[model samples]
Target: MEDHQLSKSLQSIGKSCFVKNFELFSDAAISDLDAMQFLMDDQGYEQTGARTRVREGRRIIESGRAKDALKIIADARLEDSTLADKAYRLSL
Candidate 1:
């Protein structure tokens, strides 16, 4: 992944952008993604499981923690959350 992916994500924030390209990751980009995920999660608004997982997994991937993210998905698998979906199983 590269900065362009993150840049696209930045553009997609707030308003929904359906034509998003695949997200790419950089070593230090994870922290930014963590904040984004936090914003999505800490909202008083409720989101669907898919939404939460997408946000969270983006953080995991951008954080350069794909290997660690596998553990999170494994743990969350039983809950049948979006994280357990095949796409995120490997944190891609």
Candidate 2:
């Protein structure tokens, strides 16, 4: 699905379902910044959603999901040039 359409569809169904479906359908991962945007903007999670993504991102990395975790960080930088430093720090 396209970004806007995905956002709209996520807004309609809610976060839990989105997360579940995301895990099931794709190996592609979500960046922390994108996660914040996805949760706060698309899922209506606000600031708490950003926090949730940070925690979840940390957990994913700590749990040895390194490949996926790195992809999350890399994606944020690759998708947005302005986020390079933040994404680098996030990966470290």
Candidate 3:
């Protein structure tokens, strides 16, 4: 991902935008999904899956971890055009 593009994307995700339309970076979401699945299948709490994921997402954004998450995604996507597409879709 180009630095300019990544910077623009991160700048766009302000507090109000993040709080109102909560979601995660694609990679973080996938990791959360894996943990959630484990909780539901092994720990016997189906409801914990969604609740835990949502709570975690909130914490990440509210605590400024979202910035870190987005940076990581951008770094991983660095030579891949899909970075722009992902940033656009996430409204980052």
Candidate 4:
């Protein structure tokens, strides 16, 4: 499904389901997670959601799900252009 549609469909789902479905989203996964976080922050749930996201990202990395963890990092990099640029450089 398209990202927007996927987001709409995911509105009531749990975060684990949301992250698991990220695979179907491919490149748009980052944007979808951003929008989810934005909606949470807009409702004043920022810190909790951010903490969970960070913890989950770290868990995925430490568990050796490196490539999947890249989705989380890439999603997060939207908040840090320098990190995104550094990642791009590293990738090259």
Candidate 5:
């Protein structure tokens, strides 16, 4: 698949996985840097945006800014209801 197609497909898969298994995947965590590297290598997906968000959210969680991550995910949910539902459910 073309890069655009791959990007879209990966995004879709990410969204779906989040919706379906976010509870298991949540905890406001960022996967290891090696995991991010693997994603970039295997999928050619850029991790800067998503990884940065996850890292920042993780920091907030660590710093007792738990609500910050909630707000960010809530805003994301508003932009994408499916993703929002997944995120909200994961948050619980």
Candidate 6:
């Protein structure tokens, strides 16, 4: 899939999972998987702007920066429309 398509898919999955009230830890797992898939599917994405943000957010989470991760996710959700829905549904 193209970068935009993958991004859309990720956003959609995030929103759907959030709406279903998936736990933060679970959602984080899904996000991690998606990130890996993105990496495997597209090498050029590593230098892209969106990918940079995604990596940063993932790093924050992996580092146990919960509050910062929450903030980063919140900001990302705001930019991706579907993210807010998921954030609202997941309460995270």
TM-score of each model, in listed order:
0.29, 0.33, 0.37, 0.29, 0.41, 0.33
lDDT of 6 by residue, 1-92 (tens): 34454445445434333222324333565665565455446533343533444554454335554343334345563556775555544344
List the lowest-lDDT window of 10 residues for candidate 3: 12-21
> Residue-wise lDDT of candidate 4 within 1-92, one digit each (tens)?
34353333333333343344334333333554564565365544465665454444334334444343334334553545655444334333
Number of the top candidate by lDDT?
Answer: 3
List, in order, the clash count of every candidate structure.
1, 0, 1, 0, 1, 0
| Models ranked on lDDT | 3, 5, 2, 6, 4, 1
- Summing lDDT over every window of 10 consecutive residues in candidate 2, give the lowest-scoring window: 17-26
Candidate 5 stretches greater than 4 Å from native: 1-31, 41-43, 47-54, 75-77
| Tens-digit per-residue lDDT, 12-74, candidate 2 | 433333233233223336655665666577556667655554455344434455343333444
Per-residue error for 59 in candidate 5, Å, reads 1.6
In model 6, state the lDDT of residue 62.
51
After superposition, candidate 6 runs with Cα above 4 Å error = 1-51, 71-80
Flag the better candidate by TM-score, 2 or 4: 2
Compute the lDDT of residue 71 as modeled in candidate 5. Answer: 40
lDDT of 6: 0.44
Best by TM-score: 5
Instruction: Mark the regions of model 4 whose C-alpha exceeds 4 Å error after superposition.
Output: 1-45, 71-82, 89-92
The reply for model 3, stretches above 4 Å from the true place, is 1-45, 77-84, 88-92
lDDT (Cα, 0-100) at 27 in candidate 5:
50
lDDT of 1 by residue, 10-88 (tens): 3333212111112422234545445445445554333453354456446545556555434433454344354355324
Q: Rank the candidates by TM-score, best first.
A: 5, 3, 2, 6, 4, 1
* Model 5 / residue 81 / CA error / Å: 1.1
Q: Assess each prediction's global lDDT (C-alpha) against the native.
A: 0.40, 0.44, 0.47, 0.42, 0.46, 0.44
